[model samples]
Target: MRTHNQRDAPGLRDSPSEVNGKGTSGPEPNKRRGIRGKIINALSPISVGKAKIKHKKKNEEREESKPITVDQIRELIHEKKLFEAGQHLLMMEKASYAEQSKEGKGAARSEIEAAYGLLKQEALRVIKTSVRMAPVNPELLQNTVRAIAEQVKEDKTAALEKANVLSVRPRLWKEAWKEMIQESVTERMQVPPFDGVEGLSATAHSFLHMGKAMKDDLITVVQHIKPHYPNDFRVCCVYAECYYQCFSSQLEGIAQFELGSGDNALLLTWVQNIYPNEIKKHRVLEKELEEANLGTLLPLKQIKHLEETYLINELESLKRCLARCLQMEVTRWTQGREPEKLDGHFHSELSIDAIQAVYGGQKRAKDITPDLGKQIAPLLLVELLTFLQSYKKELERFLKDNKQRQHFEATVIANINNCLSFRTHTEENTMPGQNAVKHQISVVLHEIQNAGFEVLLQGLFQELQALFKKFTQKTWLSCSSIMNEIIGCASNHMATLRTLKEPFRQAIVEKIHLHLVREHIARLVKKKVSLRSAEQQGQLSQVIQTNAATLHAFCTENGSNARWLEPVLPRLAEIIRLQHTDAIMVEVGGLASQYPDISKKHLAAILYFKGNLSTSETRGILSVLDIHLSATLPPTSLFSDIKLS
Candidate 1:
């Protein structure tokens, strides 16, 4: 009727309030429309498009006032509904942004900006917590990573579609997430808990525990986080690098501390024995880490410096241990305790302890690196050599005052065995200075053996000297008591001499034989004996021959294998007893051929004792050496040491 027709009336151009004097009739207007009018509106294309556009406009206007807020973003992110939050953020940004030619919706655009900012901050925190905290939430990480990807996509869309009206540019939140790994690892490694393991220092335990924690986390990355991430991320290597850097820094800090030998050894064990062998080369992590191309956790130079420090510390500790062992051994000896016996041989623990201390430290060093072992063995060998010298010196001092002690010879024998044991062990090892060290040890052994022999035969020299002063005189030639007394004095020392082992036993006994024989010859030199006739010479030669035979028999019987000494006295007796110059010349030539070291003083003594050879004959006898002995003496050093004067 008039209602529908009047709405489209040509003169209805006025404002609604003024044009509608029938405004109160609007409720009645719907009732006036019929089925025919509704059908026409629904079927008409223009009216359909207009109605759809009007409906969409009304919904958007309502939504624009309170489109996705910062609080909503915070709640979704907190709930870890990251994909959903990212979707809603995209929608809100698209809604708030104006077209490419116009500025974005003012307050709504600002809200979108705040929401994304909150997202970036929370997402970074999530990444960090995933690394730093335990029991990683895989789903949360997956969602966060996905959401970051979505943000990247949305930012690209925003830049391309609404370039001029862009509210916030791309942040590339994933890169920020990766960077968080370093900061996360640093904080986590700084405070690893004590593992309560036995025999490890706090620093060492910390290192071990942190390393384990890192490995465990990296395993998580390999199994869970890495598989979920795309290949381009190389998430495993990324995690590994962060852990390595943090753990390496921690190692650097631990290395700087003033550590004990045990601590250093433990550190060496971890750095060398465990880190490279067990961790980096682990079964599961090996291939991945190799591809990752992370070099050794420590640089070569840093590791080298650490190895040197550990070696020096170990050597110092070994030196201190040797000194302490020597001190304890001295106390045991001073207390007069019979040295502990092993296998019917006198024994002491000093050598055993010293060997163990040095090689044990060497083993510890080598455990860190073979190069470290090379550095330490020679240094330790030197320390042991020095200890041996100290050992000899101390024993010498002790022997002077304690010769009467019942355990004295036992102590000396035990120490000699100690040196032998040490030398044997030293030679067995292949080290830089092993041969030289062994030689030095042998020298110490020789000195110690002489020291003991000197103590055992202490006062016999004075007695023998007194009696030998009467040599070549009337009373001495008649009496056999002088030689018998010398034999008796020497025989008393032979009891202890048999207790030592072969080489040393024979060496000591020969030293005694040399002492007696040398004294016999030295007495001749001192007396300047020149027998005038055959009867006196025969008497002197007979007495010397009898005494020399007795001495040789005794010396050979009691481990003195010095047959060279045997011929020395017998030949001297033959030379002295001879009256003919040719026979004497033959003997002198034989002696010179056997002992090239026989000097002019020795020939003078022998010739003067013969009393048969004229001065020219003596000169000719000495001339045998010009051809037999060169300016460079032979290596046989026996007679040069005889001291004929």
Candidate 2:
């Protein structure tokens, strides 16, 4: 039989029966003999050749298992095969781990680890080089960062430190910051609404915490990144939003109070303090944005849209606050509560504090330092008009039922007179309440003119006619008092009354003229004057002259009504001169002679009146006047004897 070492080698082995029968003792002797045989075989040339072949194969396998070369990694990176490059790095790490685990291979393991480290650094260098060549390739930087992060997970602290440094790059920092904001926004949206007061308080606290956290993050990012991209719109927006969120949280907490109750004062105070600061902050940001030339990074249209949105939100919130305050004050006034002190003055019914607050807002609006003021001015004006309108209705209803209407009317007239006398306040520091009151009066006058001044004038004209119908000293005095009040009010607000001046003057003139005409006709009917008598004609002419002189005196005394009436005084005089057909014909002849260019319509207007002459008689008078007037004209003229009929 072959020796055990030779038997075990080259597929040779001991027989099964001999192996079983030998058991423990037999195996010990066989093991010693096999060791000697194995030594002899290892020294033999054939065994040595086999061992060399095996060792060579093992070396080849080890070489095959080695990490990917720097050249291969560079090729992958160059081809944009970032995933493959990452995989190669992972494999290198695993190979390093394997080498470290092997027994008695400490030196080789250390060498492999060093090679891996160098390859990793080289891979990162290649990635960074690629990025430098094409710095806009965000994918390259992202992949490289992710690979390094993964490889260095065991040393997370170092990895994080490295990441923080890497984020200093503008593109990298912007992307990271944007992602952070987006995540916060998404998380905020997903937060469920709370139910009760306690729940709401909890929610508010949570929002406050979140706002603080975000603000801190924003501060950190901006401190690090602003130097590189000072004009970056997104970064600037983040900074703005951070402040906005903090303020909003505080506002939201304040908003939890019932605004319609005793908390209104607190709410108003908070709003008054916050709104101006918010506007100032916005203005400063706007200036900085301009200085940074941020318009290039952010399109003008988008920036404008964002700014408008922000301003609109702020204005809307402010408007709500103001409206709530006004409503609360109105409620208080309606309930007969003592009025709040406004500018050291207590008003009984007027919500003077609310008015001052609104006026303050208007002054801010007029300043135009904040561009939102332009948009807000109109809204505030609407609110003021609405407030005035409601007050006017209340006053009308009060006067309708109250026994002291005369006293109220006298007080209002006196106030108006006082206001009119002072063209402007002598003191530079006019009280805001006083200014607001003046502005309120002005707006009220303007609105009255716009809404229904004509209607009011028409009603007054009718009232004057009714008073003239029952001509007595008491009635005339009453009419005069009404006229004085109306005229005084109009004169006090002349700028606002300018538009209705002509209509007002016309109404007055027509009313006075109608009175004069009715009186003249009544006198004639009373005298029963027969135009056939020269004496009666003289008497009628005298009546006409007296009435005309009275009208002239009335118009002259009332200068406001004289503007339109003076131009028509001659026509009135001519009308008054004609009491019968012959007199009308003669008067028309005199008018035509006085005005050589007078037309037939002019003669008819001068002669015509409602019950003065029959149609045939009037036609005959016009025909006779035309003939008489035309007879004086030159033959070449168009009017010379042109068919007087």
Winning model by TM-score: 1
Candidate 1's TM-score: 0.64
- Estimate, for each residue in 392-506, the C-alpha lDDT of model 2 and write its tens digit: 5544444345323333332222212222112222123233344565466566644433333333334444554453344332332133444344334333433322222344434
Model 1 over residues 1-645: C-alpha lDDT tens digits? 579778677433433643454564343322223566467545676766999999999999988766666677769977878778888988777656644346545766677678777777777787788753324577788887788778766567657876464646666666777778778877767765665656666877787677887777787777767755667677888888888888777777777776776776777677776777777888878877887776666667767776777777777888789899999998999886887768767788988888888779777777777877788878877887898889888998888778788788789888776766776777776565477777887788778877876765666677767877766556647658877777787788777666676677788788777777777767665545678788887877787788889888888888787777667777877887888888887887788777777777887776776666678888887777677433333334667766743
User: For residue 126, what is the lDDT in candidate 2?
Assistant: 36
Pairs with backbone N, CA or C atoms under 3 Å apart (clashes), candidate 2: 7-12
What ranges in model 2 sit over 4 Å off?
A: 1-98, 104-216, 225-397, 400-406, 411-573, 579-645
Assess every candidate by TM-score. Answer: 0.64, 0.34
Give candidate 1 regions above 4 Å deviation: 1-173, 179-202, 223-228, 251-277, 293-319, 370-386, 422-445, 459-495, 501-503, 516-563, 573-583, 599-619, 625-645
